[model samples]
Target: MAYERLYILVEGDDDKRFFEKILTPLFEGKYDQVKVWKYAQQKKEKVSQFLKSIKGMNADYIYVSDIDQEPCVTARKQYIQSKFKEIDKDRIIVVIREIESWYLAVLDDKSSKRLGIRYSNTTDNVTKEQFNDLIPRK
Candidate 1:
C-alpha cells in the first residue's frame, strides 16, 4: 500500500535518526515521504499547538516512545494519550527498555568489537548506563 506521507513521532534524536536511516529507506516507494519528528525537542506548548495544527489534515502518524521508568507499555501509552489526545492508543510504539538497545541489537560483530563491547543478538538487556560505561573516560 502506498502512503501519501507518514509521520513518525519519536521521543529522542536517536529514535528519529534510526527511523530515518532504517525505516525511511524501506518505505522508499511505499511512501511519498517519511518524516521523523522528535517530540521531545519541541516545547510542550509548541508540541500541543503543532498537534492541533495538523488536526484533520488526513495525515498518517505513528508515535514511538521509550519504556523508560514506565511499568508497562500500556501505562506509557495512556500517559501519552492523555497528553496528546490526537494520538491513537494503538499507534504508539514503545521501545523495550530504550532505543539504544535496538541499535546495539543490529550492530555487526566487527562494530561491536571496535566499540570494545561484547555483543549478543538480543540487546534488550543492554541499558544506557551499561552502554555509557563502555565509553573511554579521559
Candidate 2:
C-alpha cells in the first residue's frame, strides 16, 4: 500500500538531517511528504501523541536507530521493541554499524558534489567515525 505521507523516526538531529537531505530524495515523487522525525529529545507524552496521530492520516512510520553497543541488529531491535512496544517488528531498522554508514553509502559522486562531501563507494562496514572524519572542515 502506498501512504500519502511517510514518517521516518530516527535517533538524533544528524539522523534527521541525513534523512531529509539524502533519503528524502529517494522517496521524492513517491510519497507526498517524507518526514524525518528525530525522536530522541521529545517528551514521552509528545512522542506517544504523535504516534497515535498517525493512525488518523494516510501515513506510515518507520523506526530507524543505530546498532550502538549491541551485539547485532536483532539484539538492537529487541531493545528498541521494549520501548516502542506498539510498533510492528518489521518497521524497525537497526543499521549495521550506525546511521552514519548510510550517509557514507549515499555519498556517490553526484551526491557528494551536491552535498559538498567526498565520495565514498565502499561503506559496506563503515561507521559514524568515518562519517565524522569525512565532514568538511571550513
Candidate 3:
C-alpha cells in the first residue's frame, strides 16, 4: 500500500522542526498528506548514502546543508540529479547555505535586532538559539 503522504526528508531534527514551525502551516490540508524525515549526524553516514536510502520512498526531499563543501550547492544538486535521475530537480532543493538563514529570516524585528541581527528585510547572523527563542512554545 502507498503511504498516500507527501514525505519530505530534511538533514536534521532542527530542519524538520523549523520547517514544521513555519512552512507546514502553509501546506495544511493542501495535499493528501505530509511528513518529514530528519537525518542524524552519524559518523559513518554519508549524504549520498542518505539520498540512496530515501530515493525509493517516492517522496519530495529538501536538503538543507551548510555550504562547507567546495562548489557546494552545484555539487550536491548534480550528485542528487545524477544519482536519482527520475526525481524532479525542483523537488530536490539543496540549500548550500546554512539553515540558520531560513530560521532567522522568519523572526520578528525585535528578536532579530536583539540577536544583533539586521533584518532590513534582508541578511542576518542569528544562530539557532535565537531561532528557538522566537518559537519557544514549539
RMSD of each: 2.7, 4.0, 5.3
TM-scores for every candidate against the unseen true structure = 0.83, 0.73, 0.58
Report, for every candidate in turn, its global Cα lDDT versus the true structure: 0.79, 0.78, 0.61
lDDT of 3 by residue, 1-138 (tens): 555445566767778887787777766566456766665454324545656555766544555444445376667777656754554566667654557667666668898678665565743444556555555362
In the range 1-138, model 1's lDDT, one tens digit per residue, is 534777788878777788999888987677687788888878877777766655555667778888888899899999988987767788788988988788788788999899877868788867777766777898
Q: Tally clashes: model 1.
A: 0
Cα lDDT over the full model 2? 0.78
- The global Cα lDDT (0 to 1) of model 3 is 0.61
Model 2 Cα lDDT, one tens digit per residue, 1-138 = 664888998888788887888788998788888888888899867776777787567477888888888898888889877875666678888777777776667556998888777676777667777778777788
Worst 10 residues of 2 by lDDT: 99-108
lDDT of 1: 0.79
